[model samples]
Target chain A: MSPELARFLQDCEQDFQQALPALCQPPGSDCPAVPGGLAEAGAYSLGNGGKRIRPVLCHAAAAALGAADRTRSAAPAHALELIHTYSLIHDDLPAMDDDDLRRGQPSLHRAYDEATAILVGDGLQARAFEVIAGSDVLDAAQKVAMIGVLARASGMQGMVGGQYIDIHATGTDMDLAALQAMHQLKTGALIRAALALGGIAAGASEAQLRALDDYGRHIGLAFQVVDDILDVDGDPSALGKTGGKDAAANKPTYVKLLGLDGARQEAQQLLQAALTALETFGASADRLRELARYIVERDR
Target chain B: MSPELARFLQDCEQDFQQALPALCQPPGSDCPAVPGGLAEAGAYSLGNGGKRIRPVLCHAAAAALGAADRTRSAAPAHALELIHTYSLIHDDLPAMDDDDLRRGQPSLHRAYDEATAILVGDGLQARAFEVIAGSDVLDAAQKVAMIGVLARASGMQGMVGGQYIDIHATGTDMDLAALQAMHQLKTGALIRAALALGGIAAGASEAQLRALDDYGRHIGLAFQVVDDILDVDGDPSALGKTGGKDAAANKPTYVKLLGLDGARQEAQQLLQAALTALETFGASADRLRELARYIVERDR
Candidate 1:
């Protein structure tokens, strides 16, 4: 992990914290067309939450490749954030995850009607494309490729598929392989896509994009393994939301399939594989290397 | 319609009908990793039924504008079809309109499950972008703009927003103006967008695009008005499904808001307005003019 890279990511975090509002909040915060109380309903949750890791991954990937075209990466980055946040909204819906809290605040569906939550998710998903497709970056080929990447990652083959699988798994018995497959689609694919899009915008060679995708896949799976373990052991207060909901719901988890200790070992193996892929890039991957470690570590 | 234009659309319809199985019956349709069946499910209403009028409109828009760029419009045309089909799926959902049949076949959700229908809608929406963004026919900027147009028309400020208002209006005493506003967003916006995308792909001037959009908006509203009128007087067998459901649900409609006779008058007026917008386009809009008349006069 490079100190400069870590500091750069921190700065991006600060910048993202600032840029997200205009990208997300209604064209005007007070616009009545957005529905009464939804402004607060939307703003309260999206305004001050999330790890912002997806955007960070985009920035780091572009920066590492010496790509200076901010325009190319801007929309993709925003698209990533939008997709991630929108997923949170839907996952929190009563018919979905039904979690009452997110980032230590009342979830959007909880603070607002179930309809509003569904609508917000719909809006955010559309806006994600508007940001990327509307951005002045990349050639037609790259832009088209970018949309394909994001769409597939977020669509049936990826996040939505994962959610669909998880939704169907409620109170069902599942083994470790099935649980891993579920998380791979739900969480891992989109995260991998974030890195892939950065490479796409940067004009990385197919081989390089493939390598980064491999890295993203490993790290994304590792990230979820850590999440599952944290559910069994980490403090909920620090997580800013309830943990153990998976267990309470009889939802399967890596820790449930594997013992608590076994889950940690598996996460380490994924983190190692992720690091191995980054080794192909040597010093160019210093940030990604750190990102992998960050996934398996930290209290969040 | 110009015989040439009609032939072209008819050709596309023939091609799509043949490929429909490949498109609808994904290879891993039975994969449990996906929450819903991405493959064709019960009733197969979407691919086999409907006029496929929206896709025809997209192709017509591109062809009439002299695109010479057949490849570029493929993604956008397919995207338009997906969005149109997804709207039908959601509109027929139990939580929405609760229609059991569409185009003489069982609705997607009713034939499946509520959650499957929701997931299908989400998948279609996601896949639409994948097709558009991945298309090689347009530049990044063009693709981006097209995406923005689709998003605005489909998301909260557009189709979904209009849906919320419509659902909210159920059993409520709403006026004609309010009803018009709702339908404009729900139905007309997407039609306008489809024309705009087609024109944009052909490098249409802002004025040309605007005129096409204006024509689309007018005819779209007219189409809905005629639909409501048909519900009142249409033969159930010809309708190919249940009629009078909207009235049975006590939902607002053009006929409900305006008198039944008035709805017909409005449809005629709107059709003329649509044709009038084409006066600026010379001979290129001959097919569009014919289509507007068809929209107002169609029985199903």
Candidate 2:
């Protein structure tokens, strides 16, 4: 990883951590704090260390559009991470994936109670949009656009729909097309939304937005394909979560549909596709290009 | 009920039902339908025959603001009901209320699975904001404002916070002030948001929005107080839900904190306060007044 990209991610992580607590506060309230453990539980899950990939993608996309001030992307960046964190929390529920660990630590449901985990996830999802709606950096139109994109990506037709399909498809013979469609909604939509949000925040042109979206679509699928590969072969310690659970659960994956070598080839092709989409941009898109490679090549 | 109020509510219900299924579709997609039963489960819980109180309150508040076109309030109205329906679905989960019934039918988790229920609730909440964000009737500023209001009300400091308190307060003695604060968030916040949303949709003045909020707060309290009373005295068949569950679970309630007569008297006082808050408005607020009365005086 380049020092510049690492520094950018580190800065995003620090800024997001600082801004998140205040985001959990209810809007237009004079109260000094949220009532009880609700906020704490929310912070616990949201602050759980993860790759912060979505925020990086958002910031990189904005930079790709020649946005000088990174702060303009803050609202959408934070919102994307919050949505991502919330999905992880919900997906870890006993009724869902039934995972006991996340990010190398006890999952929210295991650390707290199941109800707390559920409510905190719900609260975080609301706070994600609330952050964008109350953003001072973005104009009203931009805020509206970002909210529409994020909500659609996070909602039924996107993340939730993907989960629904995944749960039903478990233990069933899901074809490659069906598997790709599920991942497209499950993980791909949010990744695409992250890029779109950054572009919207940066006031990208119509063509630029389409290019970012095209780049996002390839990387989004590539991210999931790599994830499936990692589950089959990556070290759990480096991954910060259990690997091989996907196969254990009998859920279909790229690694299962395609041979391991085929999955790796698919990832490389997607990385190239993602890079090709960014050819229209100059040096400003270098970070986006690098991030695409990282997404495909990261061991974790 | 007054003829005008009944007719208005019926119209809101009909319009909301027709608009809801389409709202579940992924934005900007050519897909003719949602991938699976996800939309079906969302429709089932959302169409569960609740009173449509939030949507009616929204439309009524818009009318009270002298907005002739009720269609202006449609986005917020639909958003309010979607949020309300999502909350009910989440509240019925096994880790939460553990209820098998809602609006006289099987709860989402009971009718479907827990994973489906959780995902549907999450989807509905996202779709609520999407409706407002994607509204043709509202401008960008109005959409941003409405999203902020609805998200805050449905989020940590509001409904989710209230549920957290309720879960923690169970089997423990809670005082009047503590109970009121809890109910204020759990139920009051969303009710208040309904009116505020309607007023915002109609481009209400700041003072008028405050008045609607004042009215909402009073009636919001009144709604809960009456609910507590009904749990003790009303028929389950009329309520369309199991009554006495609060007492059965040893959860705190107005009836438990204040005796049944005190709770009844409290409801009446709140109803009066709600009516008083609308004194600045003329006959345009008649529906609001009638609704306030119905909230406190209804048998079910």
The CA lDDT at B241 in model 1 is 78
User: Between which residue pairs do clashes occur in model 2?
Assistant: none
Error of 1 at B14 (Å): 3.0
Identify the candidate with maximal lDDT. Answer: 2
Model 2 DockQ reads: 0.74
What TM-score number comes out for model 2? 0.98
DockQ of each candidate's interface versus the true one? Answer: 0.42, 0.74
Please write out the lDDT profile of model 2 over residues B259-290, one tens digit for every residue.
99999889989988999999999999999999
Judge candidate 2 at residue A265 and give its lDDT: 98
Tens-digit per-residue lDDT, A105-205, candidate 1: 88887777676676667777877876776565466667668887888888877888888788888999988778878887888888988998898888888
